[model samples]
Target: MAHVATWKKDMVSEIVKDITENPVVAVVDLHGIPAPQIQSMRADLREHAILKMTKNNLMLLALDEAAKQRPGIDKLKGSVHGQCAIMATDMNPFKLCKKLEATMTPAAIKAGQLAPKDIMVPKGPTPFGPGPMIGELQKIGLQAAIEAGKIAIKKDTTLVKAGEPVPPGVAAMLPKLNILPIIVGMDLRTVFEDGTVYKKEVLAIPDDYYKTMFATAAHDARALAIDISWTTKETIVPLVTKAFREAMGLSISAAIPTKENIKILLAKADNQMLAVASKSGYKSDAIAARLSSAAAAAASVKPAAEPHKKEEKKVEVKEEEQVSEEDAAAGLSALFG
Candidate 1:
């Protein structure tokens, strides 16, 4: 049997202790992050999480040991490939993912690295003066021309597509052009929380996305409750208002007169009577005089109330004026009908 190194034993012990103490254990890929940036991220996360970089074999062994007590913790070993680190935190796995994602910084594309997105050089003036640099630009698939004593890209050019390796010449020119096409950070692969393993796809959702989804679900639930007449604080008011409105509509349609609707019903009846009399060409001087007197009384009382009353009357008049010509024609047809 090979001799067990003291340092490796200590590392495995520390990892086991962390996993046992923390509720969340995550595996993250540290492939593209630079050393200094990783240190910076570690410092930033010190208060909330502890990140440990160790050999994959050591990490797998720690996870296996943790699984003995925490059950299902060993599932994280499936994601333990490439350059990886173990993150232990009491924070929820989703929030930990977001916190780590926030540490990402855009980095310039490097030779032999796959482009993270489509790289485009804009058509505009360059910092380079007119010289062999123009040929250098042209050599890397950019259309270069002399404009206003500076090298200008004649048209926007796509140097590389996503998932394709950046050409060495293009990668070299990208820095000169001040274009960064890659983002480097601690890319979390999976997490074990409370006997459940969450993958990147589950944890990558934005906070607002979950909020919106929950709000929509709550709204749908409230609507369903109101539909089924479920009595809860949230649904009661809207349900009552709906029920009242529907009852009012039925009462008006059935011509059932209550104190609340009696005035409106009388007004409708008056309007119908006027319509019938007008169609028959029958004019009653007594009825006209009474209506004119009533209008005068209403106008006199309205002005005496307050300036606000006059403004409200003006708004009412405007609303009446806004009735469509088609509505007026329909009313006329109803009168004859």
Candidate 2:
């Protein structure tokens, strides 16, 4: 008894240390999770973060120690028994949470398993054999019968309601049908990063939803950064290049916009169209015309193209030929040649 107590104490201490150091922990309720899927989840999570499957008591003890930094982490005190997995990560917590939710598969329903959400068995045709078992299925609101020595649901049926207990007869049949509606994983979780505490809701996002949200947020942030001149290399390249070319134009009376600057300016200008519209409200064509006129003027006033050395050589040869013909007529051909 003393040995067992000591072992438990040490185990609790280890779990506490993990949660403390990681700072981001996900409490997954494994009550309805199948053994095979649980193993798969463990392997998948290891690729991106750490998953610890331990007793709830141990996890509570760890949360108690780290409660000062994460005040609400102790909310996970309950729902950590039988089968539970703790996921920890330093990356974006929401992304990780969404990833876990995507792997849910149908499993045999078990007694005492809580439904994660509403379980809706769609109504459709059932194919059952005509037998005593057929009447049993019909009793439970299922259109089923014994046909061709096999039990077939004659039509679709709603076996159980969401948040309701699975009737004994239906529960037994669930294993054969392979349907586990409840997902057992972390419900309430938290993350502590850079001195900030993020709640489990932060990670409670769908993958596609979070992806779309982040993309829009990033685009908005970039646009604001450019407008405010707070842009970094990632955000400043286009804006600065445009400004640099504009400054160069002011230096040279040349009306021609350099080819290099054309792309740069166009990109910045195109991006800032909404801002321009908000300010001056001038149509795009008018702005483009003014820019084109300036560039063309610069090109026209620029120096003409100079003659190449080869062209000068050809001109000198022509002059010599004229002189040689005159010399030949005057009997000075030898001297000229």
**Best prediction by TM-score:** 1
- Model 2: lDDT equals 0.58
Q: What CA RMSD would you report for each candidate?
A: 9.2, 18.1
Q: For residues 96-193, what per-residue lDDT tens digits would candidate 1 score against the true structure?
A: 98998888888887898987789999999999998999999999989999999999999989999888999999999998988888888999899999
TM per model?
0.77, 0.49
Q: Which pairs of residues collide in model 1?
A: none
The ten-residue window of minimal lDDT in model 1 covers 312-321
| lDDT (Cα, 0-100) at 109 in candidate 2 | 61
| lDDT, candidate 2, 94-147, per-residue tens | 666567666655566666555445554444333444457657666767766555
The Cα error of candidate 2 at residue 209, in Å, is: 5.7
**Stretches of model 1 off by over 4 angstroms after superposition:** 209-211, 233-236, 283-337
TM-score of 1: 0.77
